[model samples]
Target: MSPIELNKRQDTILQIVKENGPITGEQIAERLNLTRATLRPDLAILTMAGFLDARPRVGYFYSGKKTMTTASESMMNLKVGDFQSLPVVVAENMTVYDAIVQLFLEDVGTLFVVDEKSHLQGVLSRKDLLRTSIGTQELTKIPVHIIMSRMPNIVYCKKSDSLIGAAKKLIDRQVDSLPVVNETENGLEIVGRLTKTSVTKAFISLAETHDL
Candidate 1:
């Protein structure tokens, strides 16, 4: 027969065991306001599923092997809204030279381009500025809109997307940053950004959780 899946209560029991492991069944029942008679079935099933181990006198302990996959699953389910970084925006009319200064000052690889109305126009990366500065010093006179990437072709994401989805865009496109946008009455508004660094920080957090 196939193994039984853990129900919500069982999941909780497993968590309690992990946190307060080597704890007795009586203590687990007391913490949840449940009687040993009522909690025995769940405790038995978790132990049977290899999620918990019970000693003759030492109560319950968590099996250390299974939490790796659980932590990975939790990382994949994280939403973009909570992790996005503040946008570094420049007006479309700004000069490329000025935009270059802002780019360096902000120390970001990509900058979000916006019109006076605060609507997204395009994106600018260090490459864009470097290409503009190669032979032409007219960067001071040229408007950013002249060299900036335009919209519709921009690969972007909404605030509600998963971090894994945003990570894919960064990887597949070989780009360093993506503008997090939201559709509005006039046009798409730049809300936040997802960067390669953001993904790194997330991975670090997952690693820390796994170590715990």
Candidate 2:
């Protein structure tokens, strides 16, 4: 998604193509005093970078695309549903002690609290459990709902939401993850989870896919 910096020969090739458009690779090589075989790699790079368009018989022409697709553009196109992980959920009535155990068992930083219908109720984070554990009250006696971040305060994203938007929510809300939810007549239904790790993996995938 980053800009492709052209080398000296590449820059000259681009300029040549721009001035004398629809030029064949052999012709361009002749002007540069180089063999077509020598320029093959550069032509491939330019075409793949969106700087040039190739045709069957017409040959290569300037595409007018100054650079590869911008990072912001690519990120905005990444949907949360594509990279979201399975939701780790717990009942709101579950004891904090059990929640902590579940957290460890699942190896997740956050848990979604739901009701009998599996509708979202609140969110329990490791920090919340840790803070409560240090208190005098027994962890077994306290329900997760007592400390979980309640709805209307919980920041979440839809499956169709952009990964970049979800990432921004994570940063602005200062949370490690966001619930990927679906809207129903009752309430929000947890479909998945978008975490910082998910975003990182998505970025890595994008880079590798684009050969950036």
Q: Model 1 RMSD to the real structure?
A: 12.7
Our tally of clashes for model 1 stands at 0
lDDT value, candidate 2, whole model: 0.84
Give the count of colliding residue pairs in each prediction: 0, 0
The true-versus-predicted C-alpha distance at residue 164 of model 2, in Å, is: 0.6
lDDT of each: 0.78, 0.84
lDDT of 1 by residue, 145-168 (tens): 888878665888887898889999
TM-score of each: 0.67, 0.67
RMSD of each: 12.7, 12.7
